[model samples]
Target: MMKRVTLGLFGAWLLHDAEEWFTLAPFSARKAASGGGQVGLPWMRREISEAHAHTAVALVGVVIAAASARGYRTEGRSRFYQAALAGFGLHGFSHLGMTVAERGYTPGVVTAPIVVLPFGYYAHRELARTGVARPGLRTALEGIAVAGGALAASHALAGMLHPATSAATP
Candidate 1:
């Protein structure tokens, strides 16, 4: 059940990304028509086009899905799983921050509260219950660090692999 919760977090992230692609892409394009991928952050927005964003989201989803499967198979004790789980779960906060920062609707804003935050909190508790991760400050901090690095790397790679382009936009 705990492992399932982790997987659900990943699924929620997938949906959130979709929401961003379909809706946020336009906003980003309008924000940066200068052909830079820096929509809101350095590692985000590989391109102004929604298609590029969609592709990036899909690739990252594959990574999360694979990591979640491996973690569940290993009884939710794998570092990859833990890091990915924690990283993805905590990722919801970024959306929330973005929404608040913009003071308006952002792509992932709609799902952040309803799906992302709840799933992350739920999975964190489930992991504790399953003994996959102990409840401790150090452990939590480590998990958070790994998550940050992983997200940064994923964002960087996604942009590098595809290269931001106006062609990706509608």
Candidate 2:
């Protein structure tokens, strides 16, 4: 049950990412700015690029969750499932936090109530239903989330430190 719920959430996230990448990114910046939002030009592009990266991350998470679900059910291997869930949850939270910090709290306000709330609720309920409240599983989840969070933060910081160089001939 827990695995199924995770899979469902993963699917929903993938769909959301597809919408953001294919629809929102291309025109959102121009629309927001022209509509009187004070967002700067470069920042808009940065937001769009970040959205693309997020889409990629979510796709990876979906694959991991799907594969882990199959393996766990087939072999009674809870570790992989726990690790994948924790990683996906942590990645989602990290990106949400970073977006709030970089963009402003307003976006987080919009997303939290809509996206995070449902995902967190469903995941938590599924975990409880599956009796994954064991200490070892809990510890594994915490560790995986922490490790994934660290990696994500490092990547974001590296990008900040070494931004892309572009041609001047445009």
Model 1, residue 156: C-alpha shift (Å): 3.6
- Across 1-170, the per-residue lDDT of candidate 2 in tens digits comes to 65455465556455444544454333434434445234422323333344434443454554555645653464323555545545544445644664565464322234444564566456656666666632356745664664455445543543454345211011
Write candidate 1's Cα lDDT for 1-170 as tens digits.
Answer: 85576567567677767777687557666545645343356533323455556665676677778877777777777777776666666777877887677566667778878877787678778888877774556555666776566555665565566664533532
Point out where model 1 deviates above 4 Å. 33-39, 43-47, 137-147, 164-170
TM-score of each: 0.76, 0.49
The runs of at least 3 residues in candidate 2 whose Cα sits more than 4 Å from the true structure, single-residue gaps closed, are 23-62, 65-68, 71-77, 105-113, 134-170
| Model 1 residue 128 distance off true place after TM-score fit, in angstroms | 1.4
